[model samples]
Target: MSNPNLLVLATGGTIAGSADSATRHDYRPGQIGIDDFLARIEELGIPANLTGKQIANIGSENMTPAIWRDLHRAAVTAIGDPVCDGIIITHGTDTVEETAFVLDVTLPTSKPVVLVGAMRPATAVGYDGLRNFANAMRVASDPDAAGRGVLVVMGDRVFAARDIRKNRTRGTDAFAGFPRDAVGLVTPSALDWFGAPWRMDETARFDFSADLPDVPVLFIHAGITPEYVDRLVTTETRGIIVCGVGEGNMPDSVRERLIRLAQGGLRVVRASRLGEGLVDREPEDDANGFVAARALNPAKARILLQLLIAAGISDPAAIQSEFDRR
Candidate 1:
């Protein structure tokens, strides 16, 4: 059989950084090219025809909607190329989940798109970039990984892009668990892979950017006041995602105003600030007319709400059903 063609699209992150001589342990993105990064991987003796391209050189914090558009376009273009079997993206861990979610919804392909990143810089002692990159390449090249939509492979775990999150600030295994048993995990070595089986069909394929509105997510911290929600609602944002307290609970005062906005026809979604557990809908809270985000984080929830609104899905039952479908 011919070798699988894997496209390594490099978006600057700690994984692609190199130590700068001027500063002790200082790292810079885009300082190293994708070709050089792959050269380090060749030492592992994995047999795959690899090609590289540098799409950006900044940390993922700098990633914007425009950047997502560009990345989506790149993946779409590559999928059309006969030589390209799959695509692997090396990105910063900061916002990898968000980018992956966007691609998972937008990219119209069954080809594997594995996103990999490192919590520690390439210069750190026992940095995890090389191993993560190798494992991601292995996952991307696997025929079994196809038709799963966008996936994230880090610290040897495989997650569906829509459900993954950067749960830890500094850890090799930052992405873990799911609100539901929708996807599975991979072993430490790329030689073995396991998880809940996944299959994406036409119904699951969503037009990512079709009617996405400019929605901003606001996380409610301790001591949050009504003014915060008032400002967001008044800002004329097409949609708003409230990262509510445990179990998706919001302050009664804040909740009241959010309901007012919803009544006015503004899109509002309530998501959990806590990592795990489902958002419970209170009978009294149901009058707010806002939708519960279920298992999605504030950011991922925002992405979905934006797309759903853009798709003109306003019914509470339909939105809830869509979340359940995924």
Candidate 2:
């Protein structure tokens, strides 16, 4: 049997970064070209006909909505290609989860989509980009990896997009799986399985092809003033997501302002700033029409909200139910 054909989309991140000295602090991210990256992967002899496209060559910290739209279009076209059996995305770790979550929710393909990244630059002494890239390709080529909505392969762990979070700053094993454990693991010869995650694939959700509206996330802190909330109302922003304290709580002042905003017809979501755990709906929160983000982080919640609003979902209860399901 012929090996599966895989398409790799490279976006600039630490994996592509270069520095003169391996120990040097100063380096340039996304300095390498996609062709070079593919050539290195070719040396692995993974038995696949691999093709690559350089979608963007900038650090993922600079990831913007415009880039996201372009990437979504590219992924749709690539996945539709007859020769492409699987897809791999080389992205920066900074916003990797957010981008993966975006693709996971929007694309309904059964073929594997794997996202990989590195903590140290390609030029660093303990560079992990090459190994991670090889493993990402391995997972992509595995038939079992299909139907697993967007997987993040880093170090030796494979995470589901809906549950993965970048947990640390410097280690190669930066990503942590949540609520449910990792969906799979990477070994020397093959991809091993733990179990499949709860996926919303083919769930008849709306697409995010249009522009995402201006929905900003406000992180809460001790005694955070409600000035920003007041301004969002003044500017007539479509929605607001508060990364509230502990179980998605805010100060009394901020909560009151947010309640006012929710009462005035603007959508509100209470998401946890904490890395793990679910934010259940509270009685007071329900009274104020605040949607609980469940287990979604602030950034992911924002993306979901943007999609819901764009689809004309204005009722908080309906929106909360969507968040609950997805």
Candidate 3:
């Protein structure tokens, strides 16, 4: 697949950042347009035929569900197009994990869909975006990259979208595949895989025809009062994910309120606040009609929960099974 046709979707992040001078650390992100970004890649001596499109120019912190929907649609179109061999997304590191997870679960495509970001501004003396961008092209063009789900290539490793998380504010090695490591690694000249193809959710793809239901993530803290929990929740809310402490435990007061809410036909999931580890289903979860997040972080769990509700699967047990598979 030499000189493969790749669709590069740009949703501004640090990779497009620019500063007053090459050494100046302060800068504005998403300043470079997709046209200019593709030109820079051409300077790297890569053989791929790249086509660029700008979906949005905001920082990933301001990433919205609307942009996500557009991005997914674009990927699906690219997948079905015989001219496009694969898809690449240039995004901010802050919320790249969320965007990737949304596409991974919703867009079902065997063509490679790779997301890449840079920690330093494009004008920085040691700009890493160019290298990372080149690496993304290499991974996408690799024949073995097909059917590996969506991938996040950063710090020279390829991470499946299911477990990618940004752990650092600055630096090239800013992400980790928590509870799981990179499925493969890539460079400008080579691509390597650690194991056989592992598609976590081979049989499920979320429907995107309608607006995704908003599922809020509730942070559980010590000494939280029942009034605090009640004030934030309302009857119209469809689902909630509790980012609890240590194995997803919350204060008794908050837990009781959540249980009551769950019994009233609201979907609830418990996820850990800590960086690493899984939230297993406790003894009373089934009785209370609550679901454990399993291996997903709070942000990712919220996405999965939203898609579940949008698909009209309200049973907690059924949602739990999705948490198990996806």
lDDT per residue as tens, model 3, 1-326: 35899999999999999999998878999999999989888987899899999999878999988899889888988988988888999999999999999888887657889999999989998899998999899988875787788999998999999988888887788899977888888899999998877663253387764476767788878777778767767766899899999998898888899999999988989998888859999999989899999999999998999888988999999999999986
Select the stronger candidate by TM-score from 2 and 3: 3
Q: Choose 1 or 3, whichever is better by TM-score.
A: 3
lDDT of each residue in 1-326, candidate 2, tens digit only: 99889988889899999999999977889999999988877887778888889989999999987887877787788777877888999999999999998888888656788999888898899999988888888898886787778889999889888889888987787889776558888954778888653443453256864588778888888867989677665465889999989999989889898888889887889999998958999988779989999988898899999988888888998999989975
- Encode model 1's per-residue lDDT on 1-326: one tens digit a residue: 87778998998898987675434455775456787888888778777889988888788889887777778778988977878989999999989988998888778546889999887777777788888888887788887787778888888777788678777886697777565432545543444545533664422356657336778777888888778977766555777888888877777788777777878877777788887757755575457777777778888888888888878887766776776665
Compute the lDDT of residue 258 as modeled in candidate 3: 90
| Candidate 2 TM-score versus the reference | 0.95
Candidate 2 wrong stretches, greater than 4 Å: 196-204, 232-234
- Which stretch of 10 consecutive residues in model 2 shows the poorest summed lDDT? 196-205
The candidates, ranked best first by lDDT, are 3, 2, 1
Which of the predicted structures, 1 or 2, would earn the higher lDDT when compared with the native?
A: 2
Best TM-score among the predictions, by candidate number: 3
